[model samples]
Target chain A: MQNLVDHTVEINKLLARYGVKFGIYKNQEFHEQLFPFDAIPRVITHEEYSELEKGLIQRVDALNAFLKDIYSEKKIVKDNVVPEDFIFASSGYLPQCEGIIPPKGIYSHISGIDLVQAKDKSWYILEDNLRIPSGASYPLIARELCRRAAPGTFKENNVVDNRNYHKLLKETMDYVNCGGISVIMTPGRYNAAYFEHSYLAERSGCVLAMYNDLFVEKNQLFYRDYKGENKKVGVIYRRISDEFLDPMSFNSESVIGVPNLMDVYRAGNVAIVNAPGNGIADDKGIYYFVPKMIKYYLNEEPILKNAPTYLPFYEEDRKYVLDNLEKLVIKDVAEAGGYGVVFGSDLSKEKLEDMKQLIINESRRFIAQEVIDFLDLDIMENGEPVPRKADLRAFVLSGKETKVWASGLTRFSRNPDSFVVNSSQGGGFKDTWVLSR
Target chain B: MGIISIEKANNLYWLGRYTERVFTTLRKFYRIFDSMIDFDDAEMVYSEYCQRLSIPNIYTSGQQFVDCYIFDPKNPDSLYHNMERAYDNAIVLRDELSSNVVSYIQLALDAIASAKGTAAPLFQLQQVVDYLFAFWGCVDDYVENEECRNIMKTGKYAERIDLYIRLQYHTKDIEKEFTKFVNRMKKTNMHCNLDKLAELTEIINTKKEFNTEYQEALNCLQGIVEVV
Candidate 1:
C-alpha cells in the first residue's frame, strides 16, 4: 500500500500519456482536462459488496419494471402510488415510446446509481443515472494503470478484477441484439465522453460509428463504409441524448441524429440500449419513490435506503419543506451533474425565504432532503493527507440478470469545503476496490 | 480489413500528406538554418516553403516566419496545423493501428504545445521528428493486420514522394528515396508504373540540372496518382 502511494506521481503521468481525460464546455468552448486520480483506493469488503450487489440489483430491477409499466399499462399511476400528473407532466416522459416494448423487454439496461455512506455507516442512494451515464471509463482505465504501477499491490490483497466491464457490456448488447452487428453510435469526437464511446467499442469488438456513418434505409439501420459497403446494425448503444438520437422523431434541428432511426427502432429491426425515455425514472423527484417502487414491483423491502428526501409536490411535504428550508438541501428536479444543487445552509437568510416562496408557488419543481453527514475520504495534497468530500457511482448492468460491477468510480471534490464530486465540477477520482474473500 | 469509413479514408490520406509536409519542411529548414549562418538573406527560403506548400505568406520576417509557420495553430499549413491534422487522423483510426503509435502522435503534439515560444525551438523540432519515426517503427513492428499496414504504407509513401519532389532534392537522393517508396508501395499491393520509374531513372542519370526538368517529375507523379 505504501508502494502504491509512492508511485502516485508516476501513475498520473502514465494516465496522461494514455489521454485519460474528460471534456467540459465553458462559455460554449470545449476544453479537455485530466480527471485527477487519488492514490488511496476505496476498499470495500466482500461481505459489504455482496450486500450492495443485492441492493443495487433490486433497485435497478424495480426501475426497469417501473419503466415497462409506465410505458405499457400505467397501473402504478392508476393505483395512485404516484401522482398521475407527475408521470404525464415530467419533461422526461416521451410520448414517442408509448406502448413500444424494447427488445428483450429491458429498459435501463446499464444503470449508474450514485451512493454515499453516512457517518453512522449507513449507505444512502443519492441519485440514479439511467440515461447514458459516464465515468465508468475513468475507473476502468485507472485500474489498468494502477496494476502496471504497483503489480505487488494485487498480490497483497484479493481485489476482484473490474476489467470485465467491456465484456459485460458486450453481453448486454448481445442479449438485446436484433440479429446483426453491435455498434456504439457517437455524435462525434468532440463529445465529452467520446473517449468512452470509442474505447468501449474497441474493447467490446463493436463498431464505433458517427451519425454520418449510419443511415436508415428500407427500415433498417446500416453502417456505411468508405467503399460504399453497408453493414446492418442490430444493437446500438448510442451515447447521444434521446432528443438528439433521431431528428425526425425528437429534435428536428439536430444534425447529429439519424433521420429515420426511430422508425427502424419502431419496426423492431434494432435495439437501443437503455431505451429512450429512461430519463423519467432517473428524475430527482422520482428518486424519492424508488424504495417504494422496489417493494411495489419486487414485493421485497429495499435493502439500501435513499437519503431522507421530501418532494414539495405534496401539500404535506411542501409544508414541511418550507418550514425546514434552512436545514435541507434543495435540488432542482430537472438538473443533474452536480448543477442545480443548492445547500440550504449555504444560502443567505433572504435567499432561503425566496426558496420557500418558490417551492410554495411551484412545488413539483423541487425536492428537499436532509443532508446526510457523509464520510470523507483522505486524498494526498502537497505532501500531507487531507480529507475531501467523495461519492461512489456504482455501475449496475442488467443483461439477462442484474449484477453490480465489483468496482465503482469514486469521485472526490478537489475543493475541501465543497460536497459536489462531479467530474464536470472539477473533481478528482479514485478506484474503488472490492476485496475478494 | 477495409472497415474504414469514407470520412476516415479522406482523413488518413490528408494525415499522410500533412505529416510528410512537416517532416520534409523540417529537414529543409535545417539546411536553411545552415545557410543563415553565412547569409542574412534567408527569409526567401520561408517564402519558397509557403509557395511549395500552397499556403498563404503571412510572415514578414525570419522571426515572424519561425513564429507563424512553425508554431501558429491558426495557419492551416503551419507545422502545428500539420501535427494537429495528424493527431486527428490517428485518433479516429486507433483500432487500425497500435495504441502506442497513437500515443506517439499525442506526445508529439504535447511536446509542440509546451515548446512553442521558447528560445530553443529546434530542440522541440527534434522531439517531433523522433516521435514520427517511432510512430512508423511501431506500426511496422506491432501492427499485424496486412490491410491496416498497407493503408498506412500507402499514405507514407505517397507523402514521402510528394515531399521529396517539393524539396527539390538532388537526383541521386530522389532516386534513392523513390526506390524505397516504390518498394513499400509494392509490398502494400499498391504498384506504380514501371515505365514512369524507367523515365525517372533516365532523367536522374542524364539530367545535370534538376531545376530545368521539373515538368518530367510532375508527370511521373501524375502517373503514380493514376496507378493509385
Candidate 2:
C-alpha cells in the first residue's frame, strides 16, 4: 500500500531504534549494519499461498525423512533412491550422528526453504537450508514494525498475522523438549545473526545462552544460574554451526562449543533443534534428489519443482553441463550465504575454462542448474518503483506436524545487475504478506 | 527466560555500573566546567578532578580535558568509554532486558557520539543523560525478570555510592545512596557479604568520622556483594 510506502524512512528509524541489525566482518573487523527494509511487501494470494503451504510441508517432510534415514537406517540410500556417495562424501555428513535418532524423530525442526517464482508464475525452490537457517526473525520483526508504522495499510491489506513465528518456534522446541527448560544458544554477540538469536529468545521466552553458560553433568545439560545453581536444559535451539557445536564431538578446536554436549544429546537426555549434521540433506549436490526424495518418502508427486539442475557427479548431467556451461549457473556445495554462486554468463572465457576443468576434476563438489528466469519484484529506488531480483525464504517448522509459516523473509538484491539476495551480500528485505483471503 | 545465566547477570550488573558511571561523572564534570568559565584556574579544576577520581593526569590543557574526558574513546575515564562498555554489556543481554530496553543504551551511546560535532557540546551531552534516564525507565517497564532488574539496580546504586565517596560528597547524600544500594542488594539473588555490609554501615553511621573514614567505607562497599 502507498501508505506503507510513504513511511519507509519512519519504519527504518523504528528499526534502528530497536537496534535491528546484522553483523559483518570485513578485513577481520566486525561492523553491524542495519538490514534495510523495503516497504512494498511481497504479497501472495490465498490460493497461491495454499499451494505453497502444501508443497513446502511435503518438501520439509521428505527432507526430515531423508535426514532420519541418513543418520540411522540408510534405507533410502540402500534402496538406490539417493546415492551412497552423496551420503558419505558430503561435508555435512557427521559420523557421530549415526544411529542417534533425535527426540520425536524430527531432524529439520526449522527449515528455511528458499524459493523464487518465475515470470510465468511457477515457483522453484532455490535451495534448502536445514542447518541453522536464519532470516525468519527479520521478517517477523519487520512485520511488527510495519504494522506500527502504517496501521491503515495492514487494515486495508488483510494480511495474515506473521507475528506467531516465535510461537511456532517455541512449539517446535517444546515438542522435542525432553523434560526441562528450553534455551536458545548463540556463539556470542559477534555472530551475523546475533540479533535474531537474542530477539527470538526474547520473543519465545527462552533463556538466551552462550557455551560458557551451559555445561553437561551426569549426561544432562544444565544452565548455570547466577546464584551458582544449575537448572536442567532439555531443549537447546543452537544457532552455532554443527562443526562448532560440541568441541569433543566435532571440531576439537571450537572454543565456542560446549564440551561433551554431544554426549548429552546422544544419551537422549536433551534435544538439539534441527539435529546436528543436517547439512547432508540441504547440500546443493543433494538438491537434485529432493523431488525423488518426496516420491520415495511420501509416495506422492512433488507439488513444487526444483530449478532444472545437473549434478556434475553424474556422467550424463556432466556432459550436458559442460556443453551448456555458459548458459547455466554453477554452485559450490560447500559454500553458503550467496558466496559460491557463479552465473555462467558472468564469467570470462578464461575463467569459464578454469571452472570447467575444476568441475571435471572435482565433480562431487559442484552442481549446475539452468538460470531460472525469476520474476523481478518492485522496490522503491529514489522515488520510483524499480524492479530488482529477489528471493523468498519460507520457514517450515517440523514439530508434531509439519507446517509452513504464512509469511516469509523476502530478500532482494540492492544491485540491478546482481542476483545474490543474501543479507551477508548486501541485500535488503521486504515482508512477505500472505493474504488471509 | 526468567532464570538468567551467571554471565548475563554479570553483564547486567556492569551495564548498570557503566551507564551510571557515565551519568554521574559527566554531571560532575559539567559542574567543574561551569566553575572554569569565569575563573582562570582551569588546570587547577581538572587536576583536582583527576586526584579525586584517582585517574592519571592525561590531559595537558582545559580544552584537551573537556574533549578527552567527555569524548575520548581511548581514555578509560572518558564518558564515551563508559558508554561503550555499557553498550557492550547491554548488547548481549537483549534477551534478558528486551530490545526496547537495550535500545535506550544505544540511543545514549549515539547521543554521546553526536555531541562531539556540536558547538554546544555540553548542551548536546544533556541528551546522553536523558537517554540514560529513559534506559532505566524502559528497563523497569519491560524487564519482567525481577532478579535481573535487581542485580542491575544493585550495580547502579553501588556505582553511585562509590563515585559519591570518591568525589567527597556530603555524608547525608552518601547515607541516602547507601540505604538504596543495600535495599537493591537484598532484593538480588547474588550473595551479599553481610559482615561487609554491616562494616560499611558502621563506617557510614559514624557521621563525623564518615568523611575521614570514607576510604575504608569505599573498601567495605566494594567487597559487600560477591558474585558467588
lDDT of 1 at A404: 92
True contacts kept of each: 0.30, 0.84
Return the clash pairs for model 1, or none: none
Q: How does candidate 1 fare on TM-score?
A: 0.93
- How many clashes (backbone N, Cα, C below 3 Å) per candidate? 0, 0
TM-score of each: 0.93, 0.97
Sorted into a CAPRI-style docking class, model 2 comes out as high
lDDT of 1 by residue, B53-161 (tens): 5568888987788777778999887788888888878777655554566788888788778778788888877888888788778877866666566656666666776
Candidate 1's error at B77, in angstroms? 2.8
What does the lDDT read for residue A311 in candidate 2?
91
**Top DockQ prediction, candidate number:** 2
User: Residue A48, candidate 2: how far off, in angstroms?
Assistant: 1.0
Please give the lDDT score for candidate 2: 0.92
Name the 10 consecutive residues with the lowest summed lDDT in model 2 chain A. Answer: A11-20
Candidate 1 all-Cα RMSD: 3.1
lDDT of 2 at A126: 90
DockQ of each: 0.42, 0.80
Query: Ten-residue segment with the worst summed lDDT in candidate 1 chain A?
Result: A223-232
